[model samples]
Target: MLQLSCLCGQVRIALKQRPDFVNECNCTLCSKSGAHWSYFHPSDVEIEGETSQYSRQDKDDPAASVHFCPDCGSTTHFTLTESAISRFGNVQSGVNMLLADESDLAGVELRYPDGRAWFGETDFGYVREPRIIGQKDTQP
Candidate 1:
């Protein structure tokens, strides 16, 4: 199990097991929040404390809602909205890796996904390639 908390400890998240991999996206909200995301079923996580929420419309539907610590303003986690839930089902949620200890992620892989391109209506003039985050540095 891994324990995750905001900078001020106002919000805490407990994960039953370490994630095998994490996804880093360049979407508008994700880029600003700087979250390294690991997915799990909501039931697999334990959240404690009060969190403020920020929701936004995407593709004409409420797409996502971000939950953050009111005191420290650190983003703890995010969940898809009803529109997304209807499409993807309530099967997974994202946990911010920045809130987790490094030891808890010792062997996990980091994946870079082109979420910006995938979700945006226009090209957004930025193209990203999917790759393992640290694979290049470790290569011979």
Candidate 2:
């Protein structure tokens, strides 16, 4: 079980199961935000205590909803709104990385080079390369 919480620990999020995919993005906000990414089904995650959501509907982002904690300013997750309309229900999978223990970080899924054109020196703060986690014995 992966338990995650807000910076102040006011809002708690508990994941009963591991996410199908752990992702990393070089997008402008994501890169600058400097947070790991994990995806989970809506039913797999549980939120305790009250939290606030901040987002504005945009025609460009027709199938997205951004949810976060207002108290600690933790960007929790974003859901796919379009899938819900097709019998998927409002609850959907999203990405959240507030867990204290990142031992289970699998790896980076993809890399967007020109994400918002915020390019410069590479800063891989969220990459989960097992080789650097003391698994150097495999090196040949």
Candidate 3:
């Protein structure tokens, strides 16, 4: 199992299996939060402790509600909103992989998705190529 905690240690998350890849998005919300997200089904993840939730006030129908540790203000995770769940069933929750130690994420692929260009209609294009965590560049 993989364990992650907030800076204040007020919030904790356990994942049954490590994620294959983590997403680094460039959307306004994600960029501001500085979150590297790993997606998983809610059943595959276990979250402990109370969290403060925030939904985007800028959108009329925000897709997800972000959760954070109130004390340290660290982003912990995000869950699909009711409207989003209704629209896209079986949606996965996102855990802030940034909370995990860098050593723990060795060999994991980091993908840069172009969220800035995504408008809720089509698949996301890559903002940049993916890279393996903790791996040295062989060509350099």
Per-residue lDDT tens digits of candidate 2, residues 1-140?
A: 87777777877878887665544565645554454566666778888866665334434444555666778777666666664446556656565664545565444333223444444357445332323221233534
Candidate 3 lDDT over residue span 1-140, tens digit each: 99999999999999999999999999999989879999999899999999999999999999899999999999999999999899998569999999999889999999989998999799999977788999974533
Candidate 3 ranges with C-alpha deviation above 4 Å: 137-140
| Best of the candidates, TM-score | 3
Q: What is the Cα-based TM-score of model 1?
A: 0.81
Task: Mark the regions of model 1 whose C-alpha exceeds 4 Å error after superposition.
Answer: 120-140
lDDT for 1 (candidate 1): 80
lDDT of 1 by residue, 66-95 (tens): 888999999899888888899989887889
**lDDT of each model, Cα atoms only?**
0.80, 0.58, 0.93
Q: Judged by lDDT against the true structure, how good is candidate 2? A: 0.58
Query: Which number leads on lDDT?
Result: 3
Higher-ranked by lDDT: 1 or 2: 1
10 residues in a row with least lDDT, candidate 3: 131-140
The TM-score between candidate 3 and the true structure equals 0.94
